[model samples]
Structure formats: C-alpha cells, structure tokens
Target chain A: AQTVTQSQPEMSVQEAETVTLSCTYDTSESDYYLFWYKQPPSRQMILVIRQEAYKQQNATENRFSVNFQKAAKSFSLKISDSQLGDAAMYFCAYRSGSNYKLTFGKGTLLTVNP
Target chain B: GAGVSQSPSNKVTEKGKDVELRCDPISGHTALYWYRQSLGQGLEFLIYFQGNSAPDKSGLPSDRFSAERTGGSVSTLTIQRTQQEDSAVYLCASSLRPSGPTEAFFGQGTRLTVV
Candidate 1:
C-alpha cells in the first residue's frame, strides 16, 4: 500500500511571494507518479502539477514547481509569485505507474494574503 | 456533458436508510473512480472502474457499500443501512486512459448527510 502525507494542516502566503507545501510518501514500488491537486470552496478537485518518479528533473508549470527527492521519498510543491487564485486546499497524491488509483494526503489549506 | 457529472449535488438521508449516488464520466473516458472526503477523513479512495469492470474494489469500506458501472459510462454507488459515519462528500473522477500519466478530471461531488 502507498500512502501520502502532508504535515501542514494550513498555510498562508503573501501575494507575489513564494510558498512551499511539503509532502512525503511511503511505497515499496520503484515506479510511480506524484501529483498536486487543489480544491477550492466549490469542492472541485483540480490538478495542479504532476511528476514521474523516473524523472530526475522536477516538474514546473508556470509559477508552480516541485522539489522531488526520490531517495528521501519527498515531493514538495513550490508556488512562486503567488496569487489569490492559489488559495485552496492543496493535496499531495500518489499513484503507482502500474495502477490508476490515487492515494491522497490530508491536504493543507492555503490562504493568500493581500 | 463536458466534464464528469454527479447527480443530486446534495443528499440527506436518515440512518439505516439506503442511498444511491450516480456519476456520469466524461464522454470518452474509460477510467472512472469514486472517492470520499469528510472532516474526519480527508480523502479516501472508494473504487475504480476500467470501462464496465472494476479492477480494484479494495477501498470500499464495508460490504454494505457497493458500486457498479454500466455500459462503461454511468456508475452508481449504493450504501445500505448507512451509518452516521457515511456522511461525507462523494467525489467522482474520470481519466482518458488507464493508469500512467493522464490526470483525472473531477466532478462537483455529492455531499451526503446521514442523520
């Protein structure tokens, strides 16, 4: 079984500043996928970014990037030039390359301050 | 519909009563999933359907909970003798393909309340 952990229950960041959300996972499989999902008050889960375990280079999507450390089983998301739209409940998820099911963390509520 | 659609955006039922939740995935998507989110439990995977067949059902909390997808398109999750613990938001998602890199698109989700 694979499990994802987000230690931060809540986080706040100033607009135009940067924020990092930490995530860790436990898995015995060598190949897998990691993702960050955002859910606003609307309760709609949206995919923010994805990273493949085999890729040594981190994944970056505009202002969103990740710091993936395979040996440490860590995958953290970094949001730069943070905007109010970035405020949401962020979840870290894991999926085995061989399977489609996603295991998600408890999530960290992010608040962007003006 | 353009995205995953879940019926009865909100459902409130009495304890011990049966409840049914429906999900209609994206038109061409072959993979569908069900998940539960509550205050106590953040997000819990419920079941996965590849087409009309379920490849994994391990996440179903109990035998009282069951789900089925028909014609590889619509799915229904049924809970019998529901308990207060079953109160949560039921989310449905669909992906274009099975496994690997495809990101799943989610529905608005159905908030279930057992009283």
Candidate 2:
C-alpha cells in the first residue's frame, strides 16, 4: 500500500508572497503520479497540479508548481503570488500507474493573509 | 452532462436510517470512484469501479457500507443503519481510463448529516 504524508498541519503566507507545502510518499512502484488538490470551505475538491514520476521536469500551472523528487520520494507544492483564494485545505495524493485508487495525505490548511 | 454530477447536495437523516447517494459520471468515463471526507480529515477511498471489472470494495470501512455502479456510468453509495460517524461529505470522481496519465474529474459532493 502506498502512503502520502503531509507533515505540516497548517501553513500561512502573506499576500503576494510564496508558500510551499511539503509532501512525501512511500511507493515501491517506479511508475506513479502525484497530485495536489485544493478543497475550499465550500468542500469542492479541485486539482491544483499533477506530476508524473517518469517526468523529471516539475509540473507548473499558472501560480502553482510542484517540486517532484522521485529519487527522494518527495513531492511538494509551491504557490507563488499567493492570494486570498489560495486559502483552503491542500492535500497530497498518490496513484500508482497500475491502479486507479488514489491515496491521500492528512492535508495542510493554507492561509493566505492580506 | 458537462461534468460529474452528484444528487442531493445535502442530506440529513436520522441515525440508524438508510440513505442513498447518487453519482452521475461524465459521459464515456470508464472509471468511477467513491470517497469519504470526514471533518478535518483527508479523503478516504471507499470503492472503485473500472470498466466492466469487479468493483474494489477493500476501502469500505464496514459491512454497512456498499456501493454499486450501473451501466458503467452511474454509481450509488448506500449506507445501511447509518451512524453519526457516517456523517461526512461523500465525493465522486470519474476518469477516462482506469489508470495512467488520465486525470479524474470530481463532483461537488453530497454532504450527509446523520443526526
């Protein structure tokens, strides 16, 4: 079974600043995918960005990017120019290339302060 | 539908009663999943259905929880003798493929309150 861990329970960043949420996973499979999902107070889960294990280059989506370290088994999300809309619960998820089941971390609550 | 659709955005039921939650996956999606998001917790995988293969119910917490997908499109998660602990947001997601490079689209979810 693969497991994802987000050590930080909460994180805060000033408006227009940058914030990084840490994530790590345990997986024996070499082929897999990592994702960052944001769940706002409305309880809608939105995909932030995704990284493929085989791809060495990190994935970027607008202000959201990921630091995917396959060798170290770490995948972290970085949000630049943080805005109030970034305030939400961020979750790190893992899905093996062989399976459709997605394993998620406990989540890190991000607060973008003005 | 344009996206994954779930019915009964909010449901309130008395304890020990049964409740059914429905999910309508996007057209042509071959995989559908059910997840539970408890208060202050991450999403917990409940069940999975891929194409015509047998559904995966390993993640189900107990016998009281069961789910089924009909016609490889719509899914229903049924909770029998619901408990207060079962009160949480139930989320549904669908993907074009069972695995690999495909992204899963999520529904708004149904918030079930077992009071």
Candidate 3:
C-alpha cells in the first residue's frame, strides 16, 4: 500500500512571496506519478501540478512547481508569487502507473496574507 | 454537464437511515472515482471504476458502504444504516483515461451530515 504524508498542518505566506509545502511517500514501485491538488472553501479540488517519476526535470506550471526526489521518496510543492487565491488546503497525492487509484496526504492549509 | 456533477450538494440525514449520493462524470470519460473527506482530513479513496473492468472496492471502509456505476457513466454511493461517523464530504472525479499522464476533473462534492 502506498501512503502520502504532509508534515505541515498549516502554512502561511506573505503576498508575492514564495511557499513550499513538504510531502513524502512510501512506495516500492518505480513507475508512479505525483500530484498536488488544491481544495478551496468551495469544496472543489483542483489539480495544481503533476510529476512523473521517470522524469528527472521537475514539473512547473505557472507559479506552481514540484521538487520531486524519487530516491528520497519526497515530492514538495512550491508556489511562487503567492496570491490570495492560493489560500486553500493543499494535498499531495500518489498514483501507481499500473493503477488509477490515488492516495492523498492529510493536506496543509495555506494562508496567503496580504 | 461540462464537468463532473454530484447531486444534492448537501445531505443531512438521521443516524441509522439509508442515504444515496449520485455522481455524473464528464462525458466520454473512461474512469470515475469516489472519495470521502472528513473534516480536517485528506481525501480517502472509496471506490473506482474503469470502463468495463470490475470496480475496485478495496478502499471502502466497511461493508455498509457500497457503490455502483451504471453504463459506465453515472455512479451512486449508498450507505446503509448511516452512522454519525459517516458524515463527510463525498467527492467524485473523472479522467479521460485511467493511465499515463492524465488529469482528473473533480466535482464540488456533496457534504453529507448524519446526525
């Protein structure tokens, strides 16, 4: 069984600053995918970024990027130029390449303060 | 209709009563998933359906919880004799494919409250 862990329960970042949320997972499979999802107060979960284990280069989307260290089993999300809209519960998820089910972390509530 | 749709945005039922939650995935999606999110917790996988393949119910917490997808389109999650602990937000997501690099679109989710 694969499990994702987000050590931080809550995080705060000043407007226009950067924030990094830590995530780690336990998986024996070499082929897998990691994702960061944002769930706002509206209860809608939105995909932030995705990283393939086979890719050495980290994935970057707009201001969101991931620091994926496959050997360390670590996948952290970095948000640059943080805005108020970035305030939400961020979840780190893992999915086996052979399977479609997703395992998610407890989530870190991000508060972007102006 | 453009995205995953979950019925009864909010449901409040008495303990021991039976409740049903519906999910309408995006058209043409081959994969659908159900997840439960308790307050202050992460999303918990409940069930998954991929095309005509047998659904994966491994994540179901108890036998009291069951789900079905009809015609590989709509899905319903039923809870018999619902307990107070069953109160949580039920989320549904669908992706074009079950494998490879794909993105799953999610619904707003149904907030179930068993009192």
TM-score of candidate 1 on Cα atoms, chains taken together? 0.97
TM-score of each: 0.97, 0.97, 0.98
Better of 2 and 3 by lDDT: 3
Per residue, candidate 3 scores C-alpha lDDT tens digits across A10-99 of 999999999999999999999999999999999999999999999999999999999999899999999999999999999999999998
Residue A113's lDDT within candidate 3 is 98
Give TM-scores of chain A for all candidates: 0.98, 0.99, 0.99
DockQ of predicted candidate 1: 0.80
Ranking by lDDT: 3, 1, 2
- DockQ scores of the candidates: 0.80, 0.76, 0.83
Which of the numbered candidates is closest to the native, going by highest TM-score?
3
- Residues A1-114, model 1: lDDT tens digits: 898999999999999999999999999999999999999989999999999999999999999999999999999999999999999999999999998889999999999999
Which of the CAPRI classes, incorrect, acceptable, medium or high, describes model 1?
medium
Q: What is the lDDT of residue A69 in candidate 3?
A: 91
The i-RMS of every model, in angstroms, reads 1.0, 1.0, 0.8
Q: Which sections of candidate 1 miss by over 4 Å?
A: none
- Candidate 3 off by > 4 Å: none
Ten residues in sequence with the least summed lDDT for candidate 3 chain B: B97-106
